[model samples]
Target: MTFREGCWRRRLRGEWFPGTRLTLRALASELGTSVQPVRDAIGKLTVERVLVLRPNYSVQIPNIDRELMDEIFAIRNLLEAEAARRCVSVMTDADIDDLEEAILATRRVYWVESEIPSRVTTIQGVSRILAERCGSEALCEQLINLRARTAPYYAAALARSDDGEDAEFVTFTIRIQDEFVTALRRRDEVAAAEIRKVDLYTFQHYIYRLLDVE
Candidate 1:
């Protein structure tokens, strides 16, 4: 992948923490390149709102607050729901198969290991598959960009939860995936879209609750 693509993926994967300070030289060293490519990548990401460039020329993942998080996730809810609605018409058997496999894989992790982090990783993987199957590159790109911007906060929310109680959240996540997959399999566009909205609704509420105590 190109440096820009690599940087984009890193953001979506929540590799950086919110408010983590960074410099061009540091990123170049980490990516094993000189300053120019890293500069270009950072410029692109800043333009895309995946990173914020300070007046001092340093960059950092934006410090997330309830308002910013709600705004970003609200956009995500709309874009992804529309994508899923569009995807239902174009989805193929192979795509369904892949989704089924993803569901099974997620279940394996949940049942055997009960790791919230792993379960969350797997759930996002399924989301990527759904986005690609939507057949609108523009929609997929927007969805990814929005997710990349919020990924740090997403991870932060997950991390702040106690491990002992995270299994319930993970289980809830898997159940939602099952609902989404069922809607996809039945080619029910309304159900699929509604599911996406419901998923976002619950998550937005969760984030609000998290912020309430902070």
Candidate 2:
């Protein structure tokens, strides 16, 4: 994979926490490449607001304070819910079946200590299906950008949770996914939107609680 794609995957898997800093030299060495490609990759991600360039020639994952968290989730709730609603009318039975299978895969990996990356990927797979089928390319692009921005924080939040809380959160996520698929299967756009809202709210609640304790 290219450096940018590798960086994005790492962020989504919570391999790096919010506010984590890195130098170009370090990234180049880690990727076994020269600094120029890493610099180019950083420039692109910086434009996407996925990475922040510093005056010291370092890059950092943008930190999420409570206020920023609220802002991000608020926009996410609006856009993601709308995407879910829009996709309902467009989704085929085959698409819904695929989503159900993905959710089942999520359940299997959520409890495995070594499968956190797979768990994250499965959840993202469900979201990608909705966004792509939402029938609005602009909305889909916006949702993807928003997801990239918040992914590190999501990973950080789960990393901070206790095992019991972690399991509970994963279970809650799986239940929400199931409900969303059900709504899609029924072509109930309103219910699909509302369920999407609830999923974002629950995630925001978990992150907010973690922030409070910190």
Candidate 3:
């Protein structure tokens, strides 16, 4: 993979936390490449607003404050709901089956693992599958970018949660995913869209509360 693709994948995997500064030299060393590719990748991601370009010529993951969180979630909710609605018409049986399996895998990981980053990556992977079958390349790209931006925050929130809160969040997530799959199976567009919105809202609610307390 190219440097940009690798960087993007790492972002989606929640490998980089918010406010983490990155330098071309460090990235080059980590990836076993020269600084030129790292610089190019950083430049592209900065333009995409997935990374912040500092005046000092270093890059950082953009930190999420309450206002930023609200803005990102607002757009995510709208786009993801629309994606779900669109999928009702376009997604094949295989695609739906894949999504179901992804959800099951994520549930297993959430219950069995204490690793926040792995959990975040698996959760986002399900959304990635849904976005791909949304039947609009433009919509898929937007959703990917939005997900990349918010992944670290998702990881951070889970990391902060106690065992009880974490368990509750996991239960809520699996229940919503199950409801979503059922909606898709029935080809109920409205129900699918509404369930997706509920899922996003619940996610925002937890993250928002965590940000407020911090």
TM-score leader? 3
- Please provide, for model 3 over 97-170, each residue's C-alpha lDDT reduced to its tens digit, 9 standing for 90 to 100: 99898889877764575677788888777678879999999999999999999998887776766656667877
User: What lDDT is reached at residue 162 by model 3?
Assistant: 63
RMSD of each: 2.8, 2.5, 1.9
What's model 2's TM-score? 0.85
Candidate 2 local lDDT, 138-177, one digit each (tens): 9998877777777777666656656676677777887887
Worst 10 residues of 1 by lDDT: 110-119
lDDT of 2 at 39: 95
- Model 2 segments beyond 4 Å from truth? 166-176, 211-214
By lDDT, the better pick of 1 and 2 is 2
lDDT of 1 by residue, 55-173 (tens): 66688889866667768888888888898797788988788889779767855653465444454566466567767889999888887787777667656665565545456666786
lDDT of each: 0.75, 0.79, 0.85
Model 3 misplaced stretches (Cα beyond 4 Å): 212-214
Best by lDDT: 3
Position 94, candidate 1: lDDT:
84
Lowest-scoring 10 consecutive residues by lDDT in candidate 3? 205-214
